[model samples]
Target: MRKERILYIYPTLSSFIKGDAEILSREYEVTHFRVHPTSWHSLLRSLISQLFHLIFNLRKYDIVYIWFADYHSFLPTLFCKRFKKRCYIVAGGYDVCREKKYGYGSFTNPIRGFMTARSIKNCTTVIAVSKNIKQIIRHVFPSTNCVTIYNGVVLKPGKEDVEKESLVLTVSMASTAKNVFIKGIDRIIEVADLMQETKFILIGTERQLLEKIGYKIPDNLQVLGFVDHSHLQEIYSKSKVYCQLSRRESFCLALAEAMLYNCNPVITNIGGMPEVTGKNGFIINEYSAQNCSFVIKKALEAKTNSLGRERILSEFTIETRAEKILNLLESN
Candidate 1:
């Protein structure tokens, strides 16, 4: 039997997409399409390129696997349905989320929502990253075929050997006020204020935005702008605790990666975070600075072990995800 040819569509070449794509390539003849645009000009150019590519070559492939139900996947999914080709759409967190405060989600924006809905309706299957997402899709489109599949993580084998400091860490794309609030940056700041003795390292873009908002960076908190994975690995090795107090998440890649470095997690009780933490880490029952501080303080005192890494190796590794996905694709 011949291997199936798949057209893999993604919004961006994000870490989340790359991890799964690496494994997907091994099983199928994958043609990866990155539709994330950097500017308005590039957006138009890329769409034109995609339209031409699909119009000419879409029939050559057997499956159209869309990573996110955004504009990029809309056209290809439509094409697949029109031509009666097998296609599935993978729901990344934001695409299927319906958060009122964030003012954005797959079904939040009128125009974008229509495109997303159409894409979902057209596809044969909707692979949600978490149980929460699966529930949301089933509630909205009760007849849609939605399945839960956890995103994969890159495994770092053999327990982390670095001696952990009293360092508490968090990583996010907190460049704006909305992002800060949505990512629980304010809560982290408040926790840092209360816990003067504990050192907090927040790694993300836009450290200056916090200053502008008069956040008054406490002496205990040090905001380091974006660092690549290599530097992140170094920080993760030295850190005793990792915090992800986000308002919502599909599947937090950072929390999983941090776990591989043996950093105990202190995350908010929302979205797919709990699934990622499993029973290995502490969960913040409330979305408050006081609650987050309590969890972090408690987590810091706990003995560090391979429990976090073990969780990833057993249930969330790239190979594990790939095998499940390959089996599902082959089933049809």
Candidate 2:
């Protein structure tokens, strides 16, 4: 039997995007197209290249699978609609959000917002990473076809013999100043300052960036640049608690990964954090440092168990996502 051909398009090759591609590849012929637009010039160049690519290659694929509904997705969805091809767009938080304060989200910009909304409307289906995101999409575009598909993670078994320490951890890409605020790095620093006894480890951002933003690094907090998966797993094994105090998050893969390692989660009640945390860990309704510090203390003191690991295994495994997404694409 001949497998259907799928054209996979994404702005960046994130782990979740790569996971979806791998899933689709098991049952379909998949081709990857990266459209990273870091600047205005790059955006124009990417669009031109994509236009040409689709113009010449659109007919070969049975479906167009896009990661996010942003400028990169506008052309693919538009082309798919014109050619009567099935197009599925996975909507992460940024696409449907309108965070004006930090200038986050595609909707923060007028032109980007229009293109993103149109892309969602034109696509055959929009896959929201969380129920919160699905609600946002329906609220903004009432008639758009949308469904919730939680982002999946590969379960990493935590070593039972590994001694977990009094360490607090968070993973985020905080290269830019806006990202520092959006990912709640500021909050982490504040909490770290308040809780001087507990050690805080922040991965995926550099100490230089924090210093550049005029943030004084506390003695107990260790800021690290991005580390490989093996190193991250090692960090997860030793950490007692994982914290995600983001202003916005779609599915929070890091939180899930930490839970898989049996790290107690202390997250804000924002976007998908609460959904991901469920009853497995602590949730902080207030974003203040005092409040988050209090929550982290409680999480650190809580007994370690396999409940977090069990939740990920049952609900957010890669196998579950593969089954659901494959069925959706094949049926529609």
Candidate 3:
């Protein structure tokens, strides 16, 4: 049997999408198209160019796989109507959400919201990253065929010999300035101030901005600006507990990565975090500093186990995700 050709489209060459593209390429002949934009002018230009490109070349591929239902997906989704092409959209967090508090999310903008709705409504399938997201999609695009496929990661389990330190770790991108508060960096700082004995490491690029926003850097809290992946893995291994006290999350990839290194999770009970942590880690029912502190303390006393890593290996590997995707493609 001949392998099918797939045109994989994404807003940018983001790490997670790049990982998925690589996995998809293993089984299918994949051509990648990136509609990345740095400014409003560029966004419009890129969308126009991608639309023309898709319109002219739509027949070359057997399927079109698009990531996110924002501006980038709009054109291809529009052309799919005339061409009658089978296109699948993988909904990342922001594109599928209406996180008004942060003043972000595709659905927050009227134009983008319209584009997102049309794209999702027309796509052959909608791949929601979590069960929570699937529910959101069903409510918003009731007639659309949406399915839950938990995001997967490349697991590089840390060696058992690395002695776990008395450190608590939380990682963020820091580029989303508002997300510092949304992802509970503010609460992390508060908890650090109270738990003066324990060391808390917050990794991200916006440390300066976070401090500028009047978050007093406590003595026990160490805000290490951006670290490379290897360094992050080392920190993940050394940390006793990984905290993800977010207001909402589609799937907390950081928490999952930390689990791969055998760090016990202390995540908030929001979105798919509970699904990711499962019964292996502590889930905070409340988002108060007191509740987070209590959970961290309890997580510290609990012995580290392979349950987290084992759970990910069985269910959330990139290979597993690829297999599911392939099954979907072939079945259709």
Candidate 4:
């Protein structure tokens, strides 16, 4: 069969610049239509030019892979409808499930609902990252065909004992921002600072507000911002835990990577995280920093290294997710 010319649309180039797109492209002729951070000068510019590109380019590819973003997905819907193409949407988080419940700021709730409704209605298929998201989509768009494909990372198990240290980690784009509203950064900071022995590393970008808070970030809590994806596995290998404090996530990719490296998870019991962690990690509901501390203690004590790594390797892999997507496309 001739290779399918797949056009993958994501809000930013970051998603495609990362592992998922590269891996997917190995099987399909993938082209990415993405917006970079430097390009968005103002709202008027983005609204007019970007939207035009998104709409006009819809007919160019045999298969259009739309990333799950409520705002961006709206513009593409115009093209999808106009061209009458087969499209598949990937729902990763918040915008798909949160916007309807809490509503996004500025953008009218009805508009988001309509855009999602169109994408859900017109797409060939919808891939929900977790069961929780699948349930929400089924509830919101009853007619849409949706499937659960958990996010994952390709793991190369390391030798040396990971017990080299007893440290917990929270990885995100927000660095040292006192108000880490996204991904529960503040909560992780609160939880990390309260605990003893367990060190926290804040990888990604740096935020100024975090330094002013006077939380007295000890020598243990290191903020190494913006790490390369290749280095993440090594970071996981040296540690004993991965903690994601975010209230909303479609699937915590970092948590999965940590699990693959034999680092147990101490994640918030939300979204697809519970499904991803399953029996391998400790889950905290909302707050309860005391509980976060306790669970990390227990996971450390249990020393479920081989078993935890096994779960991630068997169940979660980018290859597996890509294969699932391929199967769905071929089946249709």
Candidate 5:
């Protein structure tokens, strides 16, 4: 039997997006399309390109799968509706949010909000990365079809002989001042300052970005920018705790990745984080540095075991996500 052909569209090729493409490829002929736009000129060019591409080639694919509902998603969803094709959009965090404080989320801008809302409503189904995101979508567009599918991770074998250290880690793609607060880098820095004895490693952001925010970095907190997957796994294996003190997060993949290495999580009670942490880790209700520091101490003293890894294995494995995604796509 011939497999269905799927057109996968995304703004950026993140790991999670790539994972979904790989999953669909097992049962479908997948074609990847990137619609990343950096400037106004590029945005215009991208829109023209997407319109022409779909106009000519959309009928070649049986289904259209998009990673996020944004400007890039607008044309695809609109075209799918016109052509009477099945279109599924994965709503990760920002697409469903309107966090005005930090100027984050798709709805923060009026034009972008309009496009995002239309894309979400017109799409055949919205695949929410968390129940929190699904609730947000249902609240805004009550009649839109939505489903909760937690993002999954591939489980890595634990190094039983390897010993964890007194290191706390966090990963965020924060570069500006607003993102510092949004991703809670400021809070992490404060906690690192307070607990001078413990070492904190922050991956995915530059030290200069933090410095520009008028904050002094403590010797204990190491800002290693971005590390490759192998190095990240090595760090995860050695770290004792993983922290995410974000003001807003839809679903944090880093926290899950850390937990897979048996790194006990210390995260804020925001978005899908508490849902991800469950009873396997610690949750901080307050965002203050003193409060976060206190929670970190508790996480540091907690017993070390495979509970974190076990939770991920049972609930958020790639195989489980693949099965669920295929079922959703194949069913009515």
Candidate 6:
């Protein structure tokens, strides 16, 4: 049979929201829809564009693939259901972790009910990026099809990991996971306060509101605004340690990226952190200032060299993640 035509929908092209579904498109005839999914109202604008695409050429594609968080998949899945076409949704991370983290009371809590088991049952399969996400999918779908595949990360050698002077950087969205709460920013401040020798940097913006609300930023802590991967690489290359202390996460690309760069990671014991870090990188439990200080101190003391670098290369590489994902997708 001719290779199946696929259309993968994204929130926007500028979000830098990378996922494995796009990798499939590269091998097949994939049409990527970069939408702006800000709210339910945003769908109005998206529907206009998508309806045009659907009416004009929906039949040209064999599969309709949606790459986004929960509820957002409803748009594409609706088309597939109406047309009786085979489609798959890629639950990057949010589909699985968000509802659980925020609970059924939050603004997005309704996703728990609307984006339910029946949604997954109506499709061929839902691609979950992490094992935690796989479990979440199975919990929702129960008896439907669910496949767990990691996000791709290509490993490189010689660009080996090395400890920097006192540069600790956190590269991520300012608002994701309500960073104001249990995320590591507070602890980063605490860590910085404890060790005056280090400069704690919080990269990325979109959280100016929270930052203004007494986020406990200290003199040692540096808010570097937002820096892309090219700039981030230079920071990571010169950084000593990486920290990921999120209240919730499915598969953190930044954490994995930090590992590939060989920055010794000091992560919290939650969600996919333990799953990804394993015994490869330094890990911590509590997000308290006290605990953050302790963990940072310990990680800073450890040897950030070839040993940790080798582990991330062997496992978290994009090549390996892509191969796993492709094999899983092709097997079905």
RMSD of each: 2.0, 1.0, 1.6, 3.2, 1.3, 3.1
- What lDDT is reached at residue 261 by model 6? 76
> How does each model score on TM-score?
0.93, 0.98, 0.95, 0.85, 0.97, 0.86
How many clashes (backbone N, Cα, C below 3 Å) per candidate?
0, 0, 0, 3, 1, 4
Cα deviation at 297, candidate 2, in Å, is 1.1
How does candidate 4 score on lDDT? Answer: 0.70
lDDT of 3 at 316: 79
Candidate 6 lDDT tens digits, 241-274: 8887776667777777777676878887776767
- Residue 180 in candidate 2 has what lDDT? 90
* Model 6 regions lying over 4 Å from their true place: 1-3, 14-22, 82-84, 98-108, 154-158, 161-163, 176-182
What lDDT tens digits, residue by residue, belong to model 2 across residues 13-75? 878988999999999999998986898988899899999999999999999999999999999
What digit string (tens of lDDT, one per residue) describes model 5 on residues 1-332? 88899999988887898899999999999998888666888878888889999999999999999999999999999999998999999999888889887789889999999999999999999999999999999999999999999898864656855798989999998867887888989888989999999999999999998888799999999999988988999999999999999999988989998988888899988999877878989888877888888889988888778877888888888888999999999994
> Residue 174 CA error for candidate 6 (Å)?
2.0
The residue-level lDDT of candidate 3 at 113 comes to 93
TM-score of 2: 0.98
Residues 132-219, candidate 1, lDDT per residue (tens digit)?
8898889988989888888887646534667889999999876677778888888888889999999999998566899887778899
Task: Return the top candidate by TM-score.
Answer: 2
Q: Evaluate residue 26 in candidate 6 and report its C-alpha lDDT on the 0 to 100 scale.
A: 53
Clashing pairs in 5: 204-225
Where's the lowest-lDDT run of ten residues in candidate 5?
Answer: 153-162
Give candidate 2's whole-model lDDT.
0.91
As a whole number from 0 to 100, the lDDT of residue 212 in candidate 3 is 80
* Candidate with the larger lDDT of 3 and 5: 5
* TM-score comparison, 3 vs 4, better candidate: 3
- In candidate 4, stretches whose alpha carbon ends up further than 4 angstroms from where it belongs are 15-17, 36-47, 50-58, 99-110, 160-162, 175-179, 205-209, 212-219
